[model samples]
Target: MEVLKERFGQIGSQSVYSFTLKNDEEMEVTVINYGCIITRINVPDADGMIENIVLGHDTLDEYVNDPYFLGAVVGRVAGRIKGGSFELEGQSFTLAQNDNTNHLHGGLKGFGKVVWDAKVMEDGVLFSYLSRDGEEGYPGNLYIEVTYRLTNDNELSIHYRAQSDQKTLLTATNHSYFNLSGNLKRDVLNHSLHLKSSRVLELDKEFLPTGRIMEVNDTPFDFTKGGTVKRGAESDYPQNVLVGQGYDHPYILDKNHDHEIVLKDPESGRTLTVESDEPAVVVYSGNSLKAEGDFRGVPSRKYLGICLETQAYPDSIHHPNFPSMVLEKGEMYSSVTRYKFGIED
Candidate 1:
């Protein structure tokens, strides 16, 4: 096992650095302090061919100009908040309407656009950031820490911890777009996906949760038996069209299953299993992806990559029956999500 660090770039007066953590199994995970972004993950296929499995850019300039969030941590609140405002403790608060009429991904420069303090851990890296009370129109001076670790067992684990000085809404998640075919050889439409979820939070036309839970029994959202992602991406279902002809809904996780979620590439025999403590996982099929120039990923197009964002239900603060995302003042907030990589054959 080894950990190496190098200067990545500069964000204002802050110096950005990238840390690479390697395991004895030939797995390497590189993370940068800028937005606590995962820059790279090199792992092997069934044929012993090691390649990068996640979408990323070649330089910091592309990262700074990226609108997709790429492979960074998103949030004071990960998803969209209704109408860019919410009531908290009998007080009305308004946030930046970056995503048209709603506050999307913590108002323009969310956690994904900030520079975090980095520390090298024994087998990983710890990235910490402090969000001022009024930063992004949130009412809390919060200190958060996210740890990224690569275990010898070929698991890339992420753990989050935080505490706020005042009550606030918070549901953070890592937004890593993964294309398991490795080296971007093909799109994810053919990647087999099996999700241990039977219900998904319904979304309205504006892509906001409608406080309704929809079943996946006979719909394109169904992934219980495991199949190619093409069903949802290529389907013209109303729900699918509501979000650029693909999935962008949060599926309520069924913890009763042993493996919560599994994504496999049949051709390369590369597999990724996701397990999280969060109640739901927002699966985005890269529905609206497009890029101007070449980068570490493939030619920009829809269904090129997919994101398995593990977090609390979106707009949970607006729905009484949903799981609460409020982190009380001085109370510790902790969550964990693990992504294990391996070969099926």
Candidate 2:
């Protein structure tokens, strides 16, 4: 394994650096300190040809100006907080309602928009950030560390660790639009996806979780068995229509298997397996990707890529039945999510 670092660009008065991690199989992953964003992931196709699969921007300016979370570490709280208000320890705290009437992806300026202190390790890069008390209407001084590692076995591992000085709500995940086909012009509708989830979190008209966990037994949201992205989207099922165009809702992961999700691009014979400790995974079909110019310098259309965001349930703080996202004072918070890349035999 080898690690290389270079100056990426300038964010305000701070200089951003990009670190590249290469393994023996010729797999390379590049990440920038700005938002600890993953800039590239070059892996081999069925024909042994290398291709970049993750969607992102070319320069720091594009990332700074881009609204889509593309390739960045998102959080403080990854999903929605209904009404932008939550009660913790008898205190009611209101957050910024950036997504319609709900608080989405932390706030207006989330962790994805901030610069992190980065350090290069033997086989990975470590990023650290300090979120002060009341930074985004949260009540704690949170210290976070996220590490991205490329293992020799062809797995891109992300490990997140955080601690709060005061009790606070915290959940985070990486938002990377992936196109396993290695063709940016094409949509991921043809790719086959299999999720180890029997139920999905139902959402309201506002796209906030309704605290209802509905079974995906016969619905379009069912991916318990492998299915194409287009088939799932084209189903006139009420849940499909309720979420707008495509799959933007979270699937409650079954904890029975080590691999919670598997995505395959039959054209390129490339496959991706997602294994995470998180309770749920939000499978976003890139319904809102209308990019004038993307990382490849081409116009991007909807469904050009997909995001399998592994994190805790959205709006879990308000639902007592859902797993708690609360981090008590003096308690360590840790989570791990891995994306393993491979080619079909």
- Over the stretch 169-272, how does candidate 1's per-residue lDDT look in tens digits? 89889999998888889889999999999999899988889998999999999998987888887898899988988899999999822688999999889999
Task: For candidate 2, write residues 42-115 as lDDT tens digits.
Answer: 99999999989988777898888878888988889998999998999899998988988789888887799888
Measured over all alpha carbons after superposition, the RMSD of each candidate to the real structure, in angstroms, is: 1.1, 1.2
Error of 2 at 90 (Å): 1.2
TM-score of 1: 0.98
Worst 10 residues of 1 by lDDT: 290-299
Deviating ranges (above 4 Å) for candidate 1: none
Give each model's whole-structure lDDT. 0.91, 0.89
Q: After superposing candidate 2 on the true structure, give the runs of residues whose Cα lies further than 4 Å from its correct spot.
A: none
